[model samples]
Target: MNLDTGSSDIWVPSVNCETPPLCKSINKYNATASSTHKQAAGSPTFNLGYAVGGLTGLRATEVVSLGGLTINDQIIGEALSEPTDSYNYPFDGTFGFGWSIISATDQNSTPLDNLYEQKQISKRLFCIKFTDQTQATQDAIPPGGELSIGGCDVEADYWRPLSVDGFWQIKMTKLEVGPATDGGNKLTLCENGCEALFDTGMGPIGGPPDEIELITKQIGAHFDKQSNYYIITPCDIASLPNVDFQFGEVTVTLTPKDYMLTVSPQICYTGFSKMNTKYQKADYLLGDPFLRKLTVIYDKDNKRLGFANLK
Candidate 1:
């Protein structure tokens, strides 16, 4: 399952589902096969739409186990219909770490909530450390990093209060280009404070079209019509300026190497993309590029997020 912090519902294809050819190839949930599974009263319809695809299912409760921590009576969706085009990936389903308020499953307590309430975890929080793909490949280390439950690392550099309850949304003060010493080239963005979502489900950094165009222009990024993405061919990685994201007093910086995904020796793709039309809930979606540089802590108990520079 994909650990998605962007959405607030757990959904897996059900054995009864026949449509979406891919669903039949992937793992499906069978309520009868699980001893802890319980169908919800009335079996309310569960419908969750995403940027790419959507799913329609029925609400159910089951014992969810994550890294040995068992969450009993966790609300889940038994998908009866799925999008084959969107679910072609290897993963069977998505395990949402988002808050319950955004959940489509009748606003029932989320799996994380159940973990805390059932004493499976001492604290209402979780931490994620994403490994840089570039570095991991060179160092021969694991690709994906660790997802620690219950508590956060003591070495966090900053903590910001969540702007809303739905997504892991926070306030961003400004976004700047260039180094800190030269005062940087501050973009006319987030001047009035912008809401940003730290989304694990997203791949690239997402923002408004105009703002992203401005950012790409500043970085000398050329849009590739074929790939529908921006690329910096013959990328002079060392010459690129640092991009800074200011959250009040705390400023997180992403170096050129951190934001560029190298496809080949001569080509590198900038990790900047426009937000999909379906999900315009935030000013920016800080995805894997931003995440690879810091350890993110989702503290639901205090309704805040913590960021620490990765070592």
Candidate 2:
């Protein structure tokens, strides 16, 4: 299963008549085979909506193991119906890390919250170190990708307070292009500021349609109507200006190398996309393209997010 910081329920496919063939292709959780399995009363259905698709399932409780640690009576959803696009991923399901406020199950606490309550970990914190796409493209197994629960290794350079306690969201103060030192040439994109969600499940950085289109145009990219993305010639990548995201007092910069998604030797795509309306709470979603540049720390206890350069 993939670790999803945007949601709040642990889900896996179930072996049932409603289960799709794609779910079977991955792995299925057999509730009947587990001695610790406890069906929720009323067999209430669980419906989870995502940025693109959704999942429908039944709720259940069972023991879940993570390395040597074991969590008993962990609340989980047994997916009976999933979107076809969900099957394209390597993960069978998602292990949500968001707060219970965003949970589909209407539970009082999440698995991570339960672990903290059980005194399994000293700190209610998790760290994510994403692999650089450029490095990953060259090597089969990039060395730096990590998901550390309870604590992190590096000291944070800046800590951004969460605007909402639900989805690891932060208040973005500004968005601009070019270096901060280059005051005359800097182009302000989102001067009014907006809320941004830190989503590990998303691959590209996303914003409002108007803002994304403006950024693409400024970066010498053309809209590919068929692909529904902004494509640029590989030659323009080197000359493109850096984009900067300001979170309160801290500003993180992403150069063309960080925000350009290489499609082929001659073609590349901008990392920005139109914000999916399904995620209505935030105007922006910062994904791997931005995350790969920093060591992100999700501090549940403090209700804040910390960022530092990768070690």
Candidate 3:
């Protein structure tokens, strides 16, 4: 299952869905196979639409176990209909680590909430440590990371209070381009500060179209209409400057190695992209590129988030 902190709902395809070729490859949940499965007939239909994909399902309850933490009577979406083309990934389902206020079920049905309420976890917090593969070579292992539930890693050096109740949103005081020592140009786009979401579900760094266009222009990144990404020549990677995201007094920096996704030896794509306006409420989305540079801790107890350099 994919762990998404930006969303607040759990969904897995059901065996009853006979969407042929699509369902054939996906692992379906069998109610009869699980002794703890319970039907939620009176519950409303489960429907959730994301930036690219969506799912329509029925409500149900089951026992969920994660990293040895067991949660009973957890509400889940038994998917009846889903777009195979959009969800054709390695994961079979999605587990939300967000607060209940954003839950599609209109109830406090998130696994994180249940675990805390049931006393299964001592703390209402979790931490994520993404492997720093920014400077990886050809022989380097593919992207991988660790998610710590119930507790946070003591390695976090700084903590920032969340600005909103739903997503793990924070205020970005400034965005600077070039080297910090050289006094990089402080972009005026966020002069008054901007709302940014620390989204784990997103892969690249996303921002408003105007802001992204400016950043790409500053870095000499050209937008590729075909691939819908800002392309940068491999040779230019070495000459690229650092991009820094300032959250209050904390400044998270990303070098060219961190912001450029190397597709191959000859081609590379900028990790910064234009945010999808359909689902974008925040001015910026600090995705994997930002998270990989700094370990993040989601503190639900105090409604704040923490960050630190990896140990």
TM-score, one value per model: 0.88, 0.89, 0.88
Query: Any residue pairs clashing in model 2, and if so which?
Result: none
Candidate 1 per-residue lDDT, tens place, 96-171, comes to 8987777888566688888888888899889998988877999999888889899866556788999876679999
| CA error at residue 114 for candidate 3, angstroms | 0.4
Model 3 lDDT, residue 65, Cα: 88
Give one digit per residue, the lDDT tens place, for model 2 in 204-301: 78788888877777777888888767888664577788888888787888889998877787888888888774454888888878888888999999
Distance from true location, Cα of 123 in model 3, Å: 1.8
lDDT score for residue 145 of model 3: 80
lDDT of 2: 0.79
lDDT of 3 by residue, 1-311 (tens): 87788788888878887554337545889888988888865665887876556778788888888888898888888877876455655778888887777787536678888888899988889988787784344548566788888886566678788887777888889888873223455444587888888888777888888889988877768898988789876645777777888877788888888888878877789998886633646788888888887779999888888887643
> Candidate 1 versus the native: TM-score?
0.88
For candidate 3, give the lDDT of residue 81: 80
lDDT of 1 at 60: 90
TM-score-best of 1 and 3: 1
Alpha-carbon error at 96 in model 3, in Å?
A: 0.5
Name the candidate, 1 or 2, with the larger lDDT value: 1
